[model samples]
Target: MANDTKIFHESWYRIANEKLCLRSSVKVHRQLFRGARWYVLSDPFNNQFYRLRPEAYEFVIRLGLDRTVEEVWMEMISAAPESAPGQEEVINLLVQLYQSNLLHYEMPPDSAKLFDRYKNKKQRIMKSNLLNIMFFRIPLFDPDSFLKNILPLIRLIMNPLGAILWLTVVGSAIKIVIDRFAEVSVQTQGIINPSNLFLLYIAMLLVKTFHEFGHAFAVRRFGGEVHIIGVMFLLFSPVPYMDATAAWAFRNKWQRILVGAAGMITEIFVAALAVFVWANTSGGLLHSLAYNMMFVASLSTVVFNINPLLRYDGYYMLSDWLDIPNLHTKATQQLTHLVEKYAFGYKRSTSQAYSLKEAFWLAIFGVLSGIYKLIVFASIIFFIADRFLLAGIIMALICCITWIIVPLVKLIKYLSSSPKLERIRLRAITVVSILLLFVVGFFYYFPFPNSFRASGVLKASEYFVVNSKVSGYVKKIEIEPGSQVSAGQPLIILENKEIDLQINEAMASLQESYAMRQLALAERPEDLATVEARIQAIQTRLDRLQHDREELVVKAEISGVWVVGNVADYLGMWIRRGAPIGQIINESAYYFASVIPEVHTSRIFDNEVKRASVKLVGQADTEVPVFRYVKIPMEQTILPSAALGWKAGGDVPIDPNDAQGVHSTEPFYEVRAYLDNNNGMKMFHGRTGKIRFELTSEPLLRQWWRSFRQLVQKRYHY
Candidate 1:
């Protein structure tokens, strides 16, 4: 067994003055990321070692006294003489033995001191506990590790992980705050136009920044490095983050913890300050903006960063707090053991290295962590429920099966792979696959509905589901579906028992009262005032009964016919009270219209409005004469007739989305004009003509703004 192991061992080392001197067969490779260089060395078949990180070197210094002869298998190589002049690098020190031409005693003492300075000048590296970890646990204090460890970290001076991270967090957070306030400032009390879930959104965004910045600046100040601050899209929403991997040399527990909490600390400060200012201010856009800013920063962090269920800020914090080598590995092992014991119901007859107590604790933590994960994952799924939920379910199912099946198969084949990385890589690949599938499948599966050019005909009519005031059966269908009618046109006749009863009761009372008035007047002409009062009561009763009967007749309030509803459904068909029999449009004056939902706009322009040809309903199919858009005040209607029907001149309504510099209308207003008709026929009362109102000939700046607004609205809603 020893002989077989020796073949893969591939190295032999001897110690001199507690420093390792090695003679090995391991091969090596060197590389760079931008200007930063790194090296890799390994046994021929397995046990790959990657060094060049300052942390690895620090590990060598701190743990060097305990390494066996076999562990001294690698060294970091650099082209430059990293140390100051007259000092030898670690590479030169370790490899000096290979240089055969050497004179030890013959060399001058000064020369010897220069050669020895490489090891002699060794600075005692200190490792501090990360402030971030402490704050994560306590959350009340600032993360001071970033500032304290900056100079101590030999490598971090050049890398800005800590700075980059916190700065990114601050920037992202500020942006979110600004955007939130910009919106909140626009709305006031009693204003119905503000955004929905506006406050929640603000809070969530603020938290995102705090969490991200905690990572970035933590790395920078903790002796790690960072660069970019960005927003990542998980299905639909934006999540901000900063890269902070520079603090590895800051091996102290405190430094790592500080980096973790830096962002959170900043978030706390910003949130607290924001609220303080908000409370002192009066109600306005500014105050609303402040409140939203603070709220977003604080809550988002608590909900997102405090849960150690995933390999994020919270996870790292938990790992440090628990003193675990790897949280994920422990979870995985416990899960496997759980399966073995509960699923297979196996009895352990063999002794294992893990004690029962440790296993018990691991099991408990694992289950709790699993529950946390369930909640977090559920939240993520819900957040992106629109398109990603289906994909998440399928991917999760596949992953569960893979976790069970692949690990067993991998035991022999890729057994050398690190368990810590396997699950992470699996998740990365799954996310990538899901995103890729969305990209390809979205275009293939969800084909857009047919689009028509937008007709200038803007919808300016209020809709009502006309209900019958009286219970009735259709006695007449004077106006058919899509037919125009007068306001007083008889829509239907009801078999109204209640209305008839009311009329009869009212008529009998009216007759009695009138008879009493006649008797009173004849009895005493001097009491004429009393007789007049009786007469007035009779007249009121008669008038009320007549009005009730007229209401049962069901006349059209406005002129247009059932353009959208069917009266035929009510024809000879019984209707109950408040049953919507049909709808009607004004005949002499009508507003051309279409509806545009927030989701899709291109469809409106391409399919309905731009390539539109207007014609009165029942007109011939020839192209209508196009007319330029005329800006007119809303609420004005251009009726086709005057004394016979409605007037020819009326005001028009403007589109709500379009802004008019002049506050012409109170509340909300629209700009519309007399709808023109051109389908080779004249426009008539109750006829709908597709109007092509040129809102703007969007080009240059206008075109760009439109595109920009649309992009923001569709993806960001800001």
Candidate 2:
């Protein structure tokens, strides 16, 4: 609840004696936000807006051109003592109104002071522009006349019927996109290529142009004026922007929300149209352009425009929908209020939230948005630095100054000068100092449990891949798959009638040749050489046939479990030379074959790894201990199993051209960790799981710094 009890600031004594009132041109409008009645004070001449609670509004309404601030306060106190604004609140309200140029003093304002105030306002705007350099905007022209000229033609489509038609078209486009998902996915990869960059930029320009116009048209449709149209450097890329501040005065929340959402809706509609054009057209300049338009439209809308974390169209829309005005600013204030009230024990500090629920939401949004901004800015800085080092470094310095240095300086100024801490300055300083030290100590000195995980598949350490040694028919199945087998154990029996007949024929011929050789030796010495040559050839053929007859049975090469796929299907089936039979795996000797990212190799190799374990994907609770590990020196693009790649529903990205999905897009080192099989966990070949390596205990700050450096080195090659 607002503090209605009277609390006067020392400066209020002088201000209370002076008579002040709002300018005649200033208008006051009633509004209800979050179930509480409020007033919006608007200065038409300056186009400025200020929101005030009902109590504050009541106090303001009582002030007149001839009435003194002290008189108004006394009358408000008599009329509603419990709901009246306190003296301090009244003084703050007057200061805000005066600063916004909505107030007129009884005496003529000094020209020099007025000029100084104007200069200060300009300086503030310049400072804000400098801080937000990444999203800076420069107004170039008035677009109201242009919007007025186009309004008549577009008025008919800015209604419910038009909305229905848009939905129908967009729905159909969504279906087409889903149907040709693969084609669209492949096209996305080419959007960033140098050959298509100009086309992509053109597409982006057109889409953003349409988006800005969408907001303008929506505002115009709802009797709002759009005075300024300009270019904004969004992430250092120039794009169209428009001022739609007129929508802020709209009585209906839905109207305000529609104005905010208009840009995204327009972008989506354009993307839907582009989808149709891209789908129907054959490969050409037009087709490529249409596809690029679709890509940019969808990407920019989702990534920047519609995302609520960033201060964009969606953020405004969310604020309006939730009945929260100036959400970002208020949330920030709420956080500051929390630190002041709770941490510093400042009694006068107050939250911008109207209720506890609002305070909770504000805190949540503040933290999330703060973190998101850091991530976004960091990414942009690194991205620019990778392209242009000197420019990027300058930008980084500016960002650090604006985001870090400026905020810290302001905080120190507040701590040193703010009157709210007059009584507890020493206490606040001591508490804040201790808190800061505690945080630093926790991050720098405390040891934390740290581990890195990688996906892998289980395999037998020693396994023999069985293949057919001779061509024949699979006559009989001597052993089943997964059954225990010994070395030289018969797994399959093969028979070939042709081989048997050939062996018999060779033996008969050999016998005949032997007889002829003997007869030649006894009767004719000259013919003995020819008979001996024939006998040698026949004996050689007989020996080969006898050897083939002995190799009719397929046997296990080593003693272990017999592993064969579709062994029964091979029974009575014709077998070919060098065909795969299966493997005889030593089940007891199982290991996990994992691929570790090149960046993480330092953590595995440089650090002393304390422990390692493997967890099967579906069996989250079961952890298989690893007894030994070996890292392959060679980096390979091929993964150990398809199960560990994207195409097979795994996390790792694979080359799109690799139909088998076993080829990784980036090279990774393969590491084999022997798993202890004594835990009674069923081990299977090709079973996918995650392997975690626990490294030596270290402070989290050091680990985070190392990981960040590794990422920078890997990505920027620094």
Candidate with the greatest lDDT versus the true structure: 2
Backbone clash total, candidate 1: 83
TM-score of 1: 0.33
* Tens digit of per-residue lDDT, candidate 2, span 74-173: 9988999877888778866877787788888764344223234354786898789879898888898888888888898668878889999999999999
Question: Residue-wise lDDT of candidate 1 within 18-43, one digit each (tens)?
Answer: 33322254434443322344333333
Assess every candidate by TM-score: 0.33, 0.89
| Superposition error at 133 for model 1 (Å) | 27
Best by TM-score: 2
CA-only RMSD, every prediction: 21.1, 3.7
Q: How far is candidate 2 from the true structure (C-alpha RMSD, Å)?
A: 3.7
- Minimum summed lDDT over a 10-residue window in model 1 is located at 1-10
Q: Count the backbone clashes (under 3 Å) in each candidate.
A: 83, 0
What's the lDDT for all of these models? 0.47, 0.85
For model 2, where is the 10-residue window of minimal lDDT? 108-117
Query: Once superposed on the true structure, which residue ranges of model 2 sit more than 4 Å away at CA?
Result: 3-6, 106-119, 385-392, 470-478, 492-553, 567-576, 631-638, 652-667
